[model samples]
Target: MSEELGMREEPRGRLYRVTHRTVYEYDDDVTSSYGRGFLCPRDFPGQRRIDHELVVDPEPEDSSTGVDAFGNHDLYFHVTQTHRRLVVDAQSTVAVAAEQTSWANWDDWADWEDVRLRLAQEPLVRQYVIDLDPPEITDEVLRWAAPTFAARRPLVEVVAELTHRIYKELRYDPGSTTVATKVSEVLAQRSGVCQDFARLAIACLRGHGLAARYVSGYLLTNPPPGQPKLVGADATHAWAAVCFGEDRWLAFDPTNNQLVSDEYITCAWGRDYADVPPLRGVIYSEAKTSTIGVSVDVAEL
Candidate 1:
C-alpha cells in the first residue's frame, strides 16, 4: 500500500519582494518503475549572480513503483521566494511505506553485471556513467575497500557496508567542510556532515565501478512523543544511491548506516551538492545573514 506524503514550506524575513516564477513537474507514467517530479526556482533567471542551482530527485535510488502490481502513489511540493534573505523550502510526502527488509534478501536477486550492461543502452543514465568514469575495480583499492565490508556480499552490500564503515570511521562535524569540499579532503579529516558522507559514498561507489549519485532531501526524524520536532534534524539531509544491475538502483545512507525507508522524503538529486542546494540566490544587500528552520511529523494511516 502507498502512504500519503505532503510537504509545506514557509519563508520569513524577506529582503527582496521581487515577483518570481516557478514550475512543478510530475510524472504519472505508469510504465516506468520510478516516477519523477521537479520544481524550479522562481526568480532564478533574474538573480543569476549567486551561481545557484537547486537539486531535485534527492530520494534514494530504486525502481519506479508505478509498474508494481501493488500500485504506489507519491506526491511532492516545492516553494520558492524571491524577496530579501532568500528562504526556499520544500516538503515531499510519499504515501507508500516501503517495508524494512534485510539487505541480504536483495543480494541473491540483484545482478550487477546485467544492470550495468542494460543501463549502457540508456542515453542519459549511460552518459552519467561515461561522464563520471566511476572507479575501476583494481587489486589495491579493492583490497583496501574490501576489508570494509563483511564476507560473501553482493556489490550493493559491499557498497553499503563500506559506506557505513566510512561513516563510522569519520566524524559528524559541520564546519569541517562545505558542500564544495572535495572527497579527498573529507577522507583526510575522516569527519564531516551529511553532505560529506554522501560525497564520500559517491566517490567510493564510483571507484568500485558503480554509478552512484548524491541526493539532498528531508528525513522524517524519529521525534519523541509530546516533544517538539528537532530543528536541524528536519531541515536538509544528504545520501547516495548506487546502480546495482538491470537498471535497478538501491538507496543507502552511510551517515545513518541504514537503507532509506518510509521516513525518508526526497527533494532533489545530482552529481554532487553543487547540483542540488536547498536555497540559493544572490541579493543586492551588502551584509546578509540567513537562518533555516524545519519540522516534520508522521501519523499512522
Candidate 2:
C-alpha cells in the first residue's frame, strides 16, 4: 500500500471547474466496452476535490467506483449494449492551493544514496522503484543523470539539478514521440511532449535507485494575449514526483521546468501512465477505423 499525505483542514486557494470530454467514433457497431478511468481529483497537501461527476453514454450495465492501490480514485464501467459511438464526460470542481514550504529543512536532508537505502526499507516507497515496462531504462539514461547525483549532494538538490538539466536540454515537440516511445529514443531525439519528458525524468531517477512516480493532472494555461479564453483550450498535463521520505514527496513539472503549484491540479498518480490513464478500455467491435478526440477546459471559478 502507498502512503496517504495528510492534507490540512483548510488550505488557501482558488476554485476551478474542469471539464474533460472524450469522444470515440467507430466505423462499425461496438457490441461491448469496458473501461477504467482515473479522472477524479485526489485530495493532497495543497488540493481538495469539492465535487465531481462522470456521464457515460449508452449507460454502462455494470459500473462501480473504488480506490486503487496507489490511493487514486478509479471508475470501472462496462457497456453491454451495442453502439457505434462512445462518449465519456468527466467534470470536477477543485480547490487548488499554493505550494507549501517543505516540512523538513532540505539542506539538512541526507544524500541521494542514503535516501535510496532508507526508502528501500519502506514498503510504500518501494512500489515505485521498478522501471516502466515499455520505456525501459538504459545505460545512457543513467549516464546522463549520474553527474547531477553526486554521492554527497543533498537529495532534493540533486533532483532539482537533474530536472533543470532535462528542461534545458530537451526540445518540447508535440508529436515527436508516442506513449510507446522508449526513453533511449527520447534521449537520442531530444524532443517530446510533457508526458515523454516526465517519463524520461522518472527513468533517470529510477536508474539512480530512487522512487519516482508519474503524475497525471491538469495545468491551467492562459489563452493567447489579446484573445478571449477558449472554452476547451486547456489539456491534461503530466509530471513526476519523487519520494523524499515515507510521508513526503516532491512533485516537479519537467515540462514547464518548475515545481508543482496552485496552477496545477493532481488527478491521479502511480508507477507510470499505464496505471492511471484518464480513460482507456477494450471494445468488442468489427470497426476497422476509429478516431478519438479529447477536449479539456480548466476554468477558474
Candidate 3:
C-alpha cells in the first residue's frame, strides 16, 4: 500500500481547484452501465486534500466508495437507467507541497546497488517485481537503461539521467498512440503522450529490478504570455515514481525531464494505468458506435 506523503501546503503556499468530467454518447440507448473510477485525489503528508466529490448522472442504483489496495479512493457505481448519454464528474480542491532542493543535487541519495539489495530483502513488494499480464519490460528496455544504472551511482542521479534521456529522445505527438500502446512500440516510435513516457520510465526502472509505479495527476499549466487562460482545457498527467526505501519514494516526469513538484496534483498510483484510470466501465448496449469527451480544468485558488 502507498502511504500519504505529508509535505503540506504551508511550504509551497499553493492551492488549486480541479474539475474533471467525462461524458459518453452512444448511437443507441445503454440499458445497463457499470463504472469503477479513481477520480478522487489522494492526500499526502505534505499535500492536503481540501475536498473532493464524485457525481454520476442518472444516479446509480448501486454505488459504493472505499479505499483501494494502493490506498486510493475507489468508487464503484451501477446505473440501471436506460440512456444514450452518461456522465461522470469529479471536482477536487488540494494544497500542493514543493520540494526545497533540486533533483540534480543527489549527494545524500542512496546508491542504485544498495537500494536494490535493500529492496530485494523486502518481501512485501511482490507486485512490483511481477510485470503486467502482457509484460512491459524487455531486453531492449534493460539495455537502453543500462548506462544510467551503472554499478554504484546514486539512485536519484540515475533516475534523473534516465528521465532526461527519455525527454530528449522522445517526441510528444498527440494522437500518435493510444492507451493500448506498448513500451516496445513507444521506444521504436520515439513519440508518445505523457502516459507513454511514464510507462516507459516505469518499464526501465523495472528492467533494472527496481520498483516503480505509475502516477496519475494534473499539472498546472500557464498559457503563452499574451494568450488568455482557457477554461476546461486542462488534461490529466502521468509520471513515474521509484521506491527509495520504506514509505519514501521519488517521483519523476520523463515527459518533462524533471522531478515531480508542487505543480503536480497526484490522484492515484498503481503498478500501471490499468490500476488507476480516471473513468472506465462496461456498458451493455446494442449501440455500435460511441464517443467520449473529457474536460479538465485546473485553476489556482
Residue-by-residue lDDT tens digits, candidate 3, 1-301:
1123354444355888888889999999999999997888888765788778788888899998889999999889999999999988888888888753478654447787888877887766657756777988888877888888888888888888999999999998889899999998999899898999999998888887788999998877564478554221378889998887675778888887778877778999999998999888999999999999988888777
TM-score of 1: 0.60
Evaluated with lDDT, which candidate comes out highest? 3
Candidate rank order under TM-score: 3, 2, 1
Candidate 2 residues 1-301, lDDT tens each?
Answer: 1123345364578788888999999999999999998999998778888778888898999988899998999998999989988999998888888764442444336788888888888887777888765546898888888889887778888777777888899988877888878888988999887888888899988888889999999977564368454211367889998887766788887877667767778999998888889899999999999999988888888
lDDT of prediction 2: 0.82
RMSD (Cα, Å) of candidate 2? 4.5
What's the TM-score of every candidate structure? 0.60, 0.89, 0.90
Q: Is candidate 2 or candidate 3 better by lDDT?
A: 3
RMSD of each: 13.8, 4.5, 4.0
Model 2 residue-pair collision total: 0
lDDT per residue, candidate 1, 265-295, as tens digits? Answer: 5545667776566444322333334443433
- Clashes counted in candidate 3 amount to 7
